[model samples]
Target: MDPTNSSTSLAFEVAVFNPSIIVGPVVLGALVDTCLFGCLVIQTYVYYANFANDHRAIRFTVAAVFATQIAHVMCVSATLWNTAVSAYDDPSKLQMLPLASAATILFTGITGALVESYFAFRLWNVSKKLLLPILSMVLCVIAQVVSLVITVQAFKTTSVAEFEVDQNTPITLALTSRVLCDLILTLSTAWYLKNQRSGYLRTTNMIDRLVLWTIETGLITRYDERRRSWRV
Candidate 1:
């Protein structure tokens, strides 16, 4: 080959190999997911080993959440493998949606809805209030339905760009409903707990700590969803 033509081809190939925009965030997300999964594993073990005497319904919920997490991680791993390894030489393949990506979205939505519903149930049990829990469940159901729609659209999409364009509305709805659900759960739980104050100083301190925990957990998930929505 002529030197000039060879250099031109090399530069073209280099440009084509650029995956930072598409694949970098995915790899980073997988890493973070794996780390969080590890933490979940530890938490699950502690729950089972120490709290074996908890209510059967609560135990079952914990098990279901753990199982969903496992599926979510597996789907994410497959997506990473398909994008970074199987399609390494074929950049065009990266533009297409992998089956695993759809599964990942479904499983992620299921996990979030499951956890939120469980918290909502707990709140109902504590406060004897029906409206807050009902609202939370409704929001969770909406988010779950939007996720299913997005997953189906992902299956039909020919390219990542097309998927983004087609599913933007559903994605936004899903994220918004989820964040709203979390906010409702957190605020309601905190409000109910605050009203349960007793005369003892120690009891008030404990309620304050519980409120803090509730807010932190809610905001963490809400912030994560907001970040994902912005990225979309």
Candidate 2:
């Protein structure tokens, strides 16, 4: 092959691969997260407006969701931009952006987990032994630790290139943590619902269903995986 032709072909390959690296996962992840958060906000407000008396818990949950949304956007944007730039230039510029994004995401994850975990505890309050509830709580804590460690480590590294190449490891770990946390809470809530006494009625029922559905959509829903298959 001619040297000039070879050089041009390699350049074209790098350009194509570089943009794909930035656009593919980052865009999909951002869109999914943004839409989910928008739905969360709408559902949160509806619940809040319906139950004006129980504003404290609703408000706190909404705040955490909003914070998580903001962090998600920041991380998504920064990551894509950093990835795009790093494709052609020195990788050092991406240093602090990932760190900051990671911190925000960690905060969001922890706060959100706490909200769900607290609600789970409240539901299981009547349990005599509390063993199941305690175990659920421990799972949430451990999941949070896993998420924090993977996320922070992924961000703190010098070159995001390696992190991005091996992105599945951390992303899978983080998702696993989120899923496990949600599963434990969901199961606990289901047990609570089954064991709920006759005295629970009216708005309490609605609240239970609403919270259940919210967590269901945010975590357990297979919408993204389906989309991935369609694209493939």
Q: By TM-score, who's the top model here?
A: 1
Minimum summed lDDT over a 10-residue window in model 1 is located at: 9-18
lDDT of 2 by residue, 1-232 (tens): 8999988855654443443444466657767867876887798778777876775865676667666666766766666666555534764353223554566567666765767677656656656547666776676676677677756775675444445545557667666766776777677676766766544675688889999999889775588778888999
> What are the RMSD figures for all models against the true structure?
19.3, 19.7
**Candidate 1 wrongly placed segments (more than 4 Å):** 1-19, 197-232
Model 2 poorest 10 in a row by lDDT: 91-100
List, residue by residue over 171-211, the lDDT tens digit for candidate 1.
Answer: 99999999999999999998887776543567879899999
Per the 3 Å backbone cut-off, how many clashing residue pairs does candidate 1 have?
0
CA shift of 108, model 1, Å: 0.7
TM-score of each: 0.77, 0.59
- Once model 2 is optimally superposed onto the true structure by TM-score, how far is the C-alpha of residue 209 displaced, in angstroms? 28
The number of clashing residue pairs in model 2 is 0
Against the true structure, candidate 1 has what lDDT? 0.89
